[model samples]
Target: MAPNQDEETLESLLEASKTPEGRSRLAASGAVATTLRHLSASSPLTLPYLRLLRNLCAGEISSQDSFIDLSGPDTLASILLSSAASVEVLRAGIQVLGNVGLAGEVHRAAVWVRFFPDGFLRLARVREREVCDPLCMVIDTCCSGVGGRQRLEELCGTDSGLRILQEIIETALKAGYREEWLEWLLFKACVEEQRFLSLFLTLSSSEESSTNLDISLTSVFKPELLTTQHAFLLDILSKCLTERPKEVTVSGKFALEILEILKMIYNIVDFTTRVNAAIPTGSPAIDLFGCSLLILRDICAWEDARPTETDKDSLVNLLLDEGLLDFVLSRLEELEPPAIVRKSMVKEDNLFPVELEKRVCPYKGYRRDLISVIGNLLHRRKRVQDKVREKQAIPLLLQQCVVDEENPYLREWGLLAVRNLLEGNEDNQKEVAELELKEPITPPEISGLGLKVEVDEATKRAKLVNISG
Candidate 1:
C-alpha cells in the first residue's frame, strides 16, 4: 500500500482504539504485533503506528498486555535507538511505553527491562518537549511503588544518569513542561532522599571540567541559571522546607537541611555580590535568597505564635544557633543604605559616592527582605529580642525605620522589628531612649517637601514630624 494510504489506515485504527470496545477488539486482533512487525527506521508509517498503539494501550489492561506479550518494547526500543528516529516518532513511541508502564508492575518491569539506564538516558538528552515530557512520564511510572526505589537509586547511581535527570529538570523548567512530575521527582530525590546534598557532594568531588551538559550542578544551584531557569527549583525547595512535619521541623532533624539551604543562599549572594557585580534586574538570586528567608521567616513566626510550643528546640532557635542572625546582620550591614538615603547623602555632600555603585544586595527590595526575616524572628519572642540586643542589632534595626526608595516597606518592617524588640522590655526601650542621635542632615528633596528632621532632646529620638504648619 502507498504510504499515505498506510498512514490513513493507522490513523483510523488510532481513533478506534480510543474506545474500550475498540481497544479490546484491536488487542484481540493482534494489532500490536502487526505494528511491531512493520516497525522500521525512517519509515513514514512509524509515528502513526506508534500513535495507534499508544491509544490502544492507554488505561486498558488487555491492550497493554498484548503490547508486552507481542514484544512491543523490543521493537520500540530499536526504533528509539536508531539514528533516524524523528522527534515525532520518538515522542509517540515513548508515550506508548509510558502508558504500558503505567499499567502494573509486570508491564513496568517489561519496559524497564528494555530501556534501563542507557536507552532512557539517550532519549533524555533530546531536549524536545514532545520527547522529554513523555519520557518523564515513562520514568515516573517505572519508578512507582516499593520495588521501584531500587530503580531510582540505580538511575541516580551513575553520574551520567544524575546529569540526565538534572538536565531534564532544567529543560522542563526553562520550557515550562510537566512541572508536577518533575517537582515530585526533585522533592523525592532532593528532600525526601537528600539527593540535593549528594548532587552538591558529587559536583564538589568531581573535576569541574567534566560538566558537559548545558546545565551543570553548579549552574543549576548558582546564579548562572538563576535568572532564566530557577523558578521551579525555588518553588520546590520552598515547599520542601515549609511543608515538612511540624515535629520534624522543630526537632533538630531539619538542621542539616536548613544549613545546606543557608549555604546555597550564602554562596549565591557571595557569587552575585563579590565574583560578579552586575546583577540582572529581577534576578533569580532575589527569588533564591527571598525564598530561603521567607521559609525561615514563616517557620519562625509559626513557632513563635504557637500556644503550646515544642520543648524540643525550634526552627528559629536552630537557625539562630546556626548563626542566621549574624548572617542577616552582616548582609544588612554590607548593603549600602537604600536609594533614598543615598540620595540624601549625595545631595547633602554635593558629591556622588562611588561606593554606592558597588553596594551589596544591589537588587531592589533585597534589604527589606532581610529585615522581614528579622521582623518575624522577633515576633513576640523575648529570647530572640534579647539575642538581637546582645548582638548590637538594635541600631541596625532602627536604621530600617526610614523611607528607602529601593527597599519598599523598609520603614514598616523596621518599626515592627523595633516594637518587637521593646514590646515588654524596659531595658531595650531605655537603651534606645538614652542612645545619642546624630544631628539631622536634610537633603534638598526633604527640604523641598517642607519636611524637616526633628530630634527630641529629652529622649534623643529622631522623628519626621511635619513642619509644613
Candidate 2:
C-alpha cells in the first residue's frame, strides 16, 4: 500500500474499533498484531494509535485476550522505553498496559514487569496536574493484588522513588493539595522499607511538626543518632518510628505497636491545641486533622478486614499485652471532653438531663477510632476485661456514652467499649455496678421555684447609705 493509503487504512481500522460493528471488523483484521507492527515503525499516528489500543481494551474481554496473545506487553514496554517516542506517546502506552493488566493476574504481571522495567513511577512527573492523574490511576491499579503489591517493592530499590515521593508530599501539602494519592504512595514505600515510616509520619503531620515539638521528633531519627549497626523494631513498626530505633524483640510487642500508632494519631489531631490553640473549621489545620483521622480509620479497617485464622491470639490479650489499655487510656488525658456537654443542661418531664445529643471535641472520628481500637481488643480478652475493671475504665466509658449526644456513632462506639468491659467477667461487672451513674440536675429543679412573700428588704447599697434611718 502507498504511504498515504496505509495511513488512511490504519486510521479507518482505529475508527472501527470505537464501535461494535467496527470492533467486529477490527477483530477480523487481527487488530493487536497490526497495531503492534505499526507501532514498531515511526509515524505521526503512533501516539494516537497507542491511545486507540487503550480504548479498545477497555470493557471488552475479547480485545484484552487478543492483545495479550499478540505479545502486547512487549510492544507497550518498547514504546515506554523508546528513545524515539515522545513523553505523550509513552503515557498513552502506559494506559493501554494498565487497562490490559486489569483482566487478571497473568496480564497484570505482564504489564507490571514490562511497564516499569526502569522504575518509571519514580520518574513520572507527578507534580504536573495532567501527568499525575493517569499515572496515579495506573499505580493504584497495578497495586490491585498481593502479587502486584509484592512487585511494587522493586520500586523502592531505587533511592529516587522515596526522594520523589517525599518531594511530591511536601510540595503538595504546601500547595494545599494534600494529594491523598501521594500519601498512599508514601505509605506503600514505608511499608516496603520500614525506615521510611518515620519519613511518612513526619510528612503526614502538620508542617509545624519538626519545629514545634519540645523534642523535635525529626531529630530523633537523624542518621548520626544510631549506632553503626542500627537495629529497628522487628515487631511493631519499622519506618513508623525512628530511622535508628531501639530494637524491641521482647514478648508482647503488639500493644506497644498499637501505642505508637495511637500516639501519632494523637499528635496529628491535637497539633493545633498542643501549643494552646484550636484549629478553625475548614482551615488547613483541621484538614490535616481530618486527614489524620482517615489514616486512623484506614488502619482499623485494614486489620478488621484481614482474613481470620484459628491460631491468632485473643483479641483483648493482643491488645493488652503491654497493658495497652493503660497506655491508651493514659493518652486520653490530652483528649478534652466536649465543652457543651460540660456546660449545657435542660429540663424534660420533671428530669434535669445533661444534654446527651450534643457532640463535643472527643466525639470526632479519631476518638471513635480509639474507642473502636479498645472495643476490638476487649471483645474476647478476659485479661483486658480485668484490667478495665482494675483501671476503672467503666466510668470513663460511661461518661462518653452519657455525654456525647451529637455523634450517634461515637455514642455507639462508647457503648461498645463499655459492653466489652461488662461482658463475661462478673467481678468487672460488679466494679462498674458500684460507680455512680447519676442524673443531671438544674438549679430550678433543686430549688423548686420558691414563692416566698416579701418582707421589708433593704438593698446592699441602701444599707451602706444608712437608708434604715
Tell me how many clashing residue pairs each candidate has. Answer: 0, 8
Cα lDDT of model 1 by residue, 80-187, tens digit: 988899989988999899889888888988898889777887887687877788887788778777567777776556575576676676667556564356656665
After TM-score superposition, what is the CA distance of residue 173 in candidate 1 from its true location, in Å? Answer: 6.5
Residue 66's lDDT within candidate 2 is 85
lDDT of 2 by residue, 1-469 (tens): 1334456676776677788777666666666666667675367878768877877787567788888888888777666666676657766776787678788777777776655534454425334433444554566566667576665655444343434344444334333332334434544544433334344333333333331222333443333332111121111132232222222121223323333444444443333332222222333333333333333222322223223422234333444454556755664433554333344444453443554443235324545655666665566566667777677665555545433333337657766776666666677655543432223211221122221111113211100011122
True lDDT of residue 271, candidate 1: 25
**Reference-based TM-score, model 1:** 0.70
What range of 10 consecutive residues in model 2 has the weakest lDDT sum? 459-468
Per-model C-alpha lDDT, please? 0.66, 0.49
Candidate 2 residues lying further than 4 Å off, grouped into runs, are: 1-15, 18-30, 33-47, 56-91, 102-119, 128-133, 136-150, 161-258, 264-316, 334-336, 344-369, 402-409, 436-469
The parts of candidate 1 lying over 4 Å away from their true place are 1-5, 19-31, 169-178, 201-316, 345-358, 379-382, 401-469
